[model samples]
Target: MSGDDAKRASDAASARDKLLWIIIYSLCSSTMLVINKLAVGANGLPTVVAGAQLAVSAAVVVVMEFAGAGVLGPFEKKRIVPFVLYTTMFAMGLFSNMKALMLTNVGAVISARCCLPLIVCSIEWFFMNRAFPNARSVMSLMGVVVSAGIYIANDTGVDIQGGAGMFWLLVWWLLLAVQMTYGKHLTENIAMTQWERVFYTNAMAIPPTIVLYYATGENELEMEDGEGAMFYLILSCVVGVAISYSGWKCRSVITATTFTLVGVLNKMATITFTIIVWPKDFSVVKTLALIASVGFGLLYTEAPLRKPKVAGAGTSPLGIKH
Candidate 1:
């Protein structure tokens, strides 16, 4: 084949692979929250549920390695330290999401998450040296925030009487923003395969999750629904592994802003399914707000990285040209 033809073919293959990763991550992540809510609600122990899923994922990694799949890389302080930091925040975010789900309906929780892309994008721009979003993208992001706010204002899905539920949701949102941005950073800058990244994140999260479980007095597992809870827990673990793998794979190919944007957009399916299955406090206004949020999210594009100025040709301390 000619050189130009070969390059074109390779680019096409890369784009196809990227789309596949996006699809896989979206499906697994979208369903994971609902499954986790079911499992946690049944047992009334979010930490226990999260810990179990992480344990299952960690074991899968070990099994893969033993089977000669070679999912893990050699131990190194630099790589391991970043994974540890990310894992700590990951565990906290997972637990807080479960807590939020317990106190509110799926629609409300996911709707609140619509605002995350703005935060993620801003963090990437300031701290990670990513470019600023264009005017159109910024407008779309603002629309997302405004729509999410409208939904939250009209929402009545919180079972909790006061602001405690909102507090948990807010905490989850912030932690998720950090996790998304840092995860993208790891994917871009860290020298590791997708499996290694997945293994490290899932395995390292187990310790902190166990600590949280016991500290929260959730050591005992309650079986309120017998087979139902067990069923959801098992389902959650299965999807957890898939998402763990696909998330890293997806992040490796996409920008932080696009990754977060895909997350918000894919939840349209989740929101529809959620409303159908658990239609608590569903209203026309809320529906319109969701449509607006996802619609505007669709309009967002990943901002290109800023071009370095070439006055002196030496990089600044922040890895950008002065």
Candidate 2:
């Protein structure tokens, strides 16, 4: 082949690989909640379910490391502090997410999650010294908040039955926001490989999850046979591991814009599928609200952080207004 022909062929190959990873990422991301819902809904043991997923994921990482995947890097003592903090937040987020899934429908969870970017960006701005989002982004954030409120108002699921359900959902939302923000901090400030971060987060989360499982008396909760639920729970763990890899793989091959778009599309697909499959407490208003929330979330792009050169200052500051 000529030089141009060779370059074209490589480009085609790259595009194909990117498409494959995008599909994988979408499937894993979309289906995980439904699977977790099935598991927790059947067993009524969100703590155990969450802990099991974490344990399985950690084991997978260990196996991958031993199998010469080269995913494991040398352990650093300095990373332990941040990793532990991240793990505690991660564990709490996982449990609360499972609990929320148990109480609410998939649509409710997705709609609530639409507000996460607002919290995350606020943390970036106030605590991380990042710049505020631009005009369009700010508008989108407002839309997300409003649409999320609409969904919440219209939602008639178990979550809205009383204060406890909303409480768990709020806990999930806040902990997830903290996890995302601090996770970004870990990436920017701490020096660790991606898989190493993954391994540490998953592994360190296991102990706390175990503590929560027994501490909450989930161990004594008598579970029914729930063969189908057991299957779904196992599938949830498998997909949990798959999502970690597929998400990273997709990000490696795609632009930030493409990644964000895929995330939006995946959530839309998940909402649609969940409605079709479960159809519990489904309403036209709720569906439209979810669509609006996710659509607005799509509009919000994170403000880029840039460090300007300072004359004679020895250290560059973190972020500046555009």
Candidate 3:
């Protein structure tokens, strides 16, 4: 076969691999939501439950590292600042997300999170000194807004005045945007293997998570006594972090667009699981609106709306040049 054919085949394989990882990540994320919901139902506090899961996940990653899994180069003395910044940002994002889960419906939380890619783009442009394709970026931003509008219109049970719920949800979105932007920044300087990155990031995230857990007066041991709580906690830690991180690492190798799109699509899993586990009555209009909102979000995040660029054109400092 010609070199061009070989390259095409290679690209196709990579795409398939990325897609698989996306699916895995989405499933894990969805499962985490389900487990979180279960924990709440069992009277477990969101902060405590999530913190426990994160602690376990971090421990697992650390154990894997010590078991000849991967060496940590990114944690070298010089890179500590960037490492801490990204990890703390991630911890804040996770904490906010758990708080939102406690306050709002899963679907609402997921829908609002669709704005993260746009936020990341904006942050890159303003703070990181990166330039995006203007037309494509505008289109994508519009799609996100339209999608969010559809979801909001369709949502019948959402209470805007639900005592800090909406506030927490919005906070979750903002923090996730920060996490993504900072994560991209850290990726630039990190020389560790994917596992090592996951291990260290989660390791660093543990301290803040634990502090939040205790400050909120939530107890991990007490939560485990509740029905199905142990199972939920285990799933949250093992599947949610470990599996999702592995999948994310694989997907990042393909394309930034693919990674962002896949991340957005994971919200659909939340909707799906919510419907299955918490099936609330709704009108046809509402149902259609929800479907459209999610569809638009997927398209907005993943669609190759950006024109293919010439090789070696100016790259985004955030690492999303393509």
Candidate 4:
């Protein structure tokens, strides 16, 4: 076979593998959400529950490190500042999200997050100096966001007004925008491997989560939920390890547009699963939003405007990429 043919075949295999990674990450991440809902519902204190999950993830990473498979880092001085910012964003984003969920109605919570693509895309176009997404991809992503907003508007009453919920949701959105964009930039521009990042960020999460856990107070703590809750918590930890590791790896290979759009789709999966498990009272708007979300997810996946790379180029050259 010609070199060109061999290169094409190799690229096909790699793309297929990355696709598999995205699929696994999305499924695992969606499952983590369900598991979190189950465990946190039984346990109360979302912050403390999050702390436990992080500790679980950390322990698993530690074992991998000792096995010589996922040793964390040399964590060079040059990268320290960015890594600090990365982990801070990581922890705050998650903490705020949990807090928002607790404070708001489902609608408000979802609305707060509906604009994530717009936030991430703006960052990519302006700060990162990347090309804008194609019109179709942008439109489809907008559809996803709009449908979600509509669902929220038509389906539920405002459970909390002029409260901490909106504030936390706004905070969560901004932090997550920074978290993901900086994370991709760190993996793309810096010297850290994916495993080092997975370890460091998970390690970094522990301190903040513990702080949040303590802040939640002794009164909120429940020593015993149930035997079943323990199972869900343990299972959540195992799925979480996959979620963190694959997420880091996937971001390393894709554009911000692709990563966050994939996230929108992942949310759809979680919400879909939520509806199925509980059989919630639904409105016409709610059903439409769910259906449209899945449709847009399919469209975005097929036409995801990825980062520019030279065709059949295995090694990269110096300088900026569009």
Provide the TM-score for each candidate, comma-separated.
0.80, 0.71, 0.75, 0.84
Cα-based RMSD of candidate 4: 4.8
Give the best candidate by lDDT: 1
Runs of candidate 1 exceeding 4 Å displacement: 1-11, 92-112, 157-174, 277-280, 308-322
Better of 1 and 2 by lDDT: 1
Worst 10 residues of 4 by lDDT: 313-322
Expressed as tens digits, the lDDT of each residue in 22-62 for candidate 3 is 55666676666666788767755776666666666667767
Please give, for residues 269-297, the per-residue lDDT of candidate 4 as tens digits. Answer: 67766675677674566776877876765
Against the hidden true structure, what lDDT does model 1 obtain? 0.78
lDDT of 2: 0.69
List clash counts for every candidate, in order: 0, 0, 0, 0
Best by TM-score: 4
| 89 Cα displacement, candidate 4 (Å) | 1.5
| TM-score of candidate 1 to 2 decimals | 0.80
lDDT of 1 by residue, 29-128 (tens): 9889789988988777777778888888888988999999977789999999999999888878878987888776665675667768778888989998
* Pairs with steric clashes in candidate 4: none
Model 2 per-residue lDDT at 89: 85
